[model samples]
Target: MAFEHPYGSYNVQGSLNEWFRVNVTGNGIPAWMPSAFIHYDFPETGLISGHSGHAFSLTHQGADPIQQYQGRIVGDGQRGTLMESTLEVNCWLSREKAGGAYTHRLRHMGDMVSYIFQSARDVPLTNVYGSTTDPENVTALIRIKPANEQPVLPDPNPDIVRRRFLIDYRWLERVSAG
Candidate 1:
């Protein structure tokens, strides 16, 4: 059963090529699960906030290892500013159980970033099974606009045009697992 998921969004106003850091951590889940640290850059105007350019590093607990992925935001030059942008991310995940594998064609729209993680093995005597013991997906959306422009509603942060949308696994599905 597919459902419509709502993610967070962020709005940041500045010149193109500006750099930002996105930090992610695990909550209510195993610390050993994969987490990501992302550094992104806005290459130019008219490009979606997510599409600009960015680097990502995947980290896990109890292991002195990290895997890196780099991606770029490509858009049609003909499209004017405020146009929708599509981003494609290609990265690798390394885990004790799964080892290293490539993830390609993961697409993000606007400023939305989605992460799906699964356990390598499920615990016996439990509903958990297969490569993913309990699958979790988290998504974040970022919106960048002019500070002076008045939104339909009052601005939460008037200083900058930034807003973030966040959603987790619990919101997406009603499943109990360890």
Candidate 2:
């Protein structure tokens, strides 16, 4: 019998770009809110550089009057902590349904980690700080929007002080374009 390499040959060249379909859920998110997507452009050196680099863009595709809403991502190392587990990409979204711009963070903590840590599904009870970026995983958290402009429906109760939500990121299969 002839010997053969178990991990023979495969193509592994070019930039590491990816796309994700993010779903926003929670009482905090108004029912009228639309779905969002994130396009991550890996740096020349690839995923490693992307961790500390600014390379994300946002877009929305849904039925609504909102127009020309665009977003950009910037590296937010200052906002991150030493214990951070996911890559932190700060995103600024424009022209939300309620009529204004908003900022959020795309925690690029790989899929399994996000699920295990519940980073997007649940808010930490004890404020664990730190951040990191994964090669191909993500979750979203919206913050900094004023209490009045938060992505929530008009509430009847005056005592309600805060809103909660879960923004999840799912990897979209990549397709080659001619």
Candidate 3:
């Protein structure tokens, strides 16, 4: 029931969860891993924290296909096609960044938080489909949301302190099955 975390050696004491199997793709690639790395491109008062593969989980907010009306009617009286899908990314960040490993973790957290707030660019999320071993990359472009504050979470390990950042990402279009 142990899942890998990008911070090195630490694993969340539970499985990757079942939702990933049904709603997600990528041979069990940890849902928390960012599709790719985005360097800091915005103004910030704090020191630049580097990046790493942080832990996160993705879940759908509503039905598989959430739709909205375009407010314009087509000739066929079709008012709705498809509404973009919303994904809730539960990301983990460490509040305490003093320890040796945590110091590196701090930088990773900063990079993510900064990107979330000033997300001028779309973050690409890649998942492996079919098998974890022979996984093929399936990509989806999504929006990163801003967090008002950091909320503390219970750390399974006695040494590390964990915080949860609930991130919202929406795909403007359906992910292509390329």
Candidate 4:
């Protein structure tokens, strides 16, 4: 019988991420609230409350930890103490029937993670270090405006325009005060 290498290499370039998993336990998802120096971007709607605004939230239920939105770690090494399970990202819109619940997904690169969270079904979460260069992702995420709607100025926060958005986690940090 001829001897053959059963483990012969086929292709191992970008297949490593196929099994990539990380459990981020840094106080869970942050509660993002619009800063006081902010202006109304979208039209006047109940979606964004005048007080707290519509903060984003995550739910472990139905949240798949297989691919995206999967990270776990312990108190050992660079990991945390508890093995925080991944969660499903959902939002609580102040305005009824304002936002759309579209199938969201997460994308990761190295240690940095980006969410596929979108308010409307059309919008998609764009990663900062990703190649999801679909402009629709932004438009879809924001509340669609009417054709006759007045044009608005660019957001002061450049991050909002960039694929990587700024999610204010200060609220989380405050509550976690030592």
TM-score of 2: 0.21
lDDT by residue for model 1 (31-118), tens: 3233332434332342212322222321111111122212211232221112222122222222222322111211221122332222
Task: Give each prediction's root-mean-square deviation over alpha carbons.
Answer: 22.1, 20.1, 13.7, 20.6
TM-score, predicted candidate 4 vs. hidden true structure: 0.18
Give residue 108's error in model 1 in angstroms.
17
lDDT of 2 by residue, 4-111 (tens): 211111000000111122222222332223332234333344221222222233222111221221221123311211111122222222222223212222222222
User: What residue runs in model 2 are displaced by over 4 Å at the alpha carbon?
Assistant: 1-29, 42-86, 95-178
Winner by lDDT between candidate 2 and candidate 1: 2
* The best candidate in terms of lDDT: 3
Model 3 TM-score, all chains together: 0.36
Clashes of each: 16, 6, 7, 11
3 or 4, greater by TM-score: 3
TM-scores of all predicted structures: 0.21, 0.21, 0.36, 0.18
Which regions of candidate 3 are displaced past 4 Å? 1-66, 70-108, 121-141, 147-150, 172-178
lDDT of 3: 0.36
In candidate 4, stretches whose alpha carbon ends up further than 4 angstroms from where it belongs are 1-52, 61-84, 96-178
Residues 55-151, candidate 4: write the lDDT tens digits. 2222222111222211323212222111112222223333222223111211111012232212111212222232213211211121111111122
